[model samples]
Target: MHIRDPIHGAIEITPGERRLIDSRAMQRLRHIKQLGFAELAFPGATHSRYAHALGAMAVATRVFDAALREAPLAPAERGRMRQAVRVAVLFHDLGHPPLSHTTELALPPLGALALPEWLVDDPGRQASHEDMTLKLILDSELASVLERSLSDCALTATDLASLLTGRTPPSGAPFVAGGVDYGPVLRQIVSSELDADRMDYLLRDSLFTGVNYGKFDLDWIVQNLCHVVREESAWLALQRRAIFAFEDFLLSRYHMFMSVYFHRTSIGYEAMLRRWFEESSDAYRLPADPQAYLGCDDVELWSALRGSASEWARRIVERRAYKVVYEEHPKDPHQAPAVESALRAAGLPVIVRRSKGEVSKYFGARRGIFVRTERDVVPVESYTPLFERYAEAAVLVRIYVPPEVREEARTVVARVLS
Candidate 1:
């Protein structure tokens, strides 16, 4: 099947890829916005994970093709690796809730719907879209396609898990920690720092959000991804791959964060969504449990909000839609309470949420991005300097209050600025 994507242009897929894309679960992405509530601000930021995933898989295919030319894979191994990569791209967004990451912080009546309950609370516990992704695929249409098209059962349940999480399988191959070994060449293509996922999203997001900062030289980046064989200690390592577009990818991510993801008003709108769901009774019909939230996508969430047994959901989703009342930077953390006090006194219901490391007191509480490095993929913090910079940067704190309190917020901001 061929798709003419607005961001990546023409997208081609095999029959198996088409089946996976057409799956009921994968189709759920249409309602799950890539930048949830972002369109409320940008108007054009309504792209969905479905599009991004297609673009990502396309990039993966191109990268794998190029890398194989450099060091071709055996026929058997190449087929397995391709299937794994396709599965990985298809299921990457399976766990994301309706609004994508916009609803990431809101606790479902049952923790996260994506991973098992253990992974949500225990950050160290092996929690990933990859793990959940594999589970979805092995149990879904992707599994059927793998059996039908390739006729190779190499993509075992465990192999799917390993591909998504970047873990090396046991016994058969002495897979080094954090290094992928799906043959030498294809692994390099799919798992590198400057891999398909980043390449697709940067350009795709730029087009969707109407932001130009993420645009870069794509063909150049792909062409430059050559093998970097290095000898360390006694052994010669064949797995070293150049981070051809890594810096560009990192910089593009940073720009996307600043320009689109973290826009203050966008943050405020997301905060409103969070408040409506958490404080409103209508959004939560079930007890706080993972099973309740599991498989509940955007449509269900919105449906619950509109017809929730709780009064809060009815009011926000039904009547007001919860408008933003106040927004401003915290010149001094000490004054946050004062701002909160003034807004409350003025008759608006107020809630404040901060980014990690924004306050010295919450130092160790912040979760940094984890990367699968040559050494480790556990904490993305250790491998990349870019993520560390993001962690330390002062995150924006959004305060959401009832619209009736808008006058009070304006009064408080005027006083603070004066």
Candidate 2:
């Protein structure tokens, strides 16, 4: 199947891949929007996760093929490695909750997933969307399909799961060849800070949102990808010359978070959705069963909201979302309380959301992508000043109020800001 994506042009899917894509688990992504409430802010940002999945797979394939050129892997292992990364990236977002990360607050406890000890160490904590994806791949019918598709390469769902989860693959098999482990580098292509997801999403989100903040030199970055070995484990590395493009990619994601992802309108709606999910927890619960998850898309969630009687649900379903009365920057003080207090005193309902945008969570401990110079290899963070400049996570604190009381909320905000 040839998928014509606006971001990657033509994305080709093989017969084996088609079976996975056609599975009910994958089709659920079609009803789930990529940006969630972001569509309310950017009208054009109504793309589905299904589209993003295909785009990420396409990007990962290119990265693997390019970086593999520098790796010394046996011919037999090369095909398996390539297929593993492709499957890993393609299903990475399969477990995302309805409306992306918003409704994750409504998920069951980690123990509910029944994941193996090797996969998740803490089953007592709240489950994440990724946990759901992992179960879907490991235990659901999708797992059967995944295993059968990978039968040719002798790869099981657990092996592919290991690639995404960064765990041991059926006996700590690290794609070893001649005593060198190439698993790290291969997994990094689908994940890591410079993975295929970021590569495609930056450009895809930018195009769909009608913003240039997420646009980066992807072609240049991909062409300059160089594989390197660190402590005997292969790692993803960038050519010294393409370091500028890598910096731009980091900045692009940062800018998108501030300008698009963290837009106040979407934040306000998300806050309301969170409230509704909490209030209606018993009435609308997320199932632990993977097969039941096929019906748990945004459509079902929206329908529940539309049919509910709760004030939060009514506002979200009626498109009468709360308006952002004030925003606090990363360096600003915490004044959301004062505004929210004054609004409550004035008989107003308010939602205070603190959205944290990390500059690069992966670059903090010198474990990020490597900058391969002609002489030596260093952590990308140490190689670029951009990391230090963006070291502090960008914080956006927003105070939201009903549209009818927006003016009154602004009055409260002005007093708080003063």
Candidate 3:
């Protein structure tokens, strides 16, 4: 299938991917916003997960080609690596809840329940999507297509193993399999600090949000990639690691958090969505999951907010969101009290308090995976004055002004920030 994406022109996906994209599960990604409430602030930032996935796959393919050129792999291995890279990128966030991560964190219990029933009760489970993805690939018709794409019958087994372990197919294996890690060489392309996923998203998000800060010289950086032996393993390295390219990527993420993703006005919009979701199952009484109200792509969690019988969803859909009553940037990274105080002062409802510590937990909050070596702890801030300038910055506070007092509340916000 030829998908003409605004960001990446023509993205040619295989028939198997086309079928997967057409599935109700994958199609739901169309309704899920790539930037969540970001479109409320940057009107153009309404791209969906469908687009991000396709774009990421395209980028991954390019990175795969680069890896092959730098250190050639067997034709059979390269074909399998392509399947693994494409599948991994395509389904990376298939389990993201409605409103993406925002609602995922906000509606934990419902979010918890909304996950496939199979995953909800299992303590031994990985991510719901990861499990479902493997299940779908192995049991569904996708299995044969993916195998055919790789020309290997055991691709699914190898792919599953790779995601489970960060290692790729053994050199003795006839082919590599798709997962977060396929082969060490392919893993470097998909992961690594400077990989295709970030490269694509930075540009893709910037383009969708009307920001230029996220773009780097992707062509130049890709060209500079070279293979180097690090600790007896071959790894891809960039000539300069394109410090400027990386600086742009990091700065873009930072600014997007400030100006786009966390815009105070949008916070008000999301709070409205949160309230709507809260009333989803209670006798406050709703007929449907709000997830139905959004476009087809955004379907990980039912947008119970959009389907709420409550006045909240109606108000928000009608653009009657809250205003920002107060704003603050905490000076210390660990200042929980400051966040609590600001929320109290604004008189906004509490949802979740995400500490840096909480944010650090990944792969379903089991524990963080760290790669330890003799190298110095990455002083990310030390590398660039830009990062150093914001090192002490901890938290950003936004007090959502209920729709009723927006104008008056705007004044309060100005004074509080001042």
Judging by TM-score against the true structure, name the best candidate. Answer: 2
Q: 187-300, model 1: which lDDT tens digit per residue?
A: 434444456777777787788778887887777656544333222101101222323245455667666766677775566666666666666644433222323334556677
Shift of residue 84 alpha carbon in model 2, Å = 0.5
lDDT of 3 by residue, 177-279 (tens): 2322235555556555555667777788889888876766777666655554433344444444455665565566666566666666666666666676566
Q: What is the TM-score of each candidate against the true structure?
A: 0.73, 0.96, 0.70
TM-score for candidate 2, please give it.
Answer: 0.96
User: In every candidate, how many clashes are there?
Assistant: 9, 0, 16
lDDT of 2 by residue, 52-79 (tens): 9999999999999888786777777898
The candidate 2 region of ten consecutive residues with least summed lDDT is 276-285
Q: Candidate 2, which segments miss by more than 4 Å at Cα?
A: 281-283, 331-334
Q: What TM-score does model 3 achieve against the real structure?
A: 0.70
Candidate 3: which stretches are off by over 4 Å? 15-24, 105-154, 157-182, 231-234, 278-306, 330-394, 406-418
Tell me which residue pairs clash in candidate 2. none
lDDT of 2 at 368: 62
lDDT measured at residue 310 in model 3 versus the true structure, 0 to 100: 67
Count residue pairs with overlapping backbones in model 2. Answer: 0
Best-to-worst order by lDDT is: 2, 1, 3
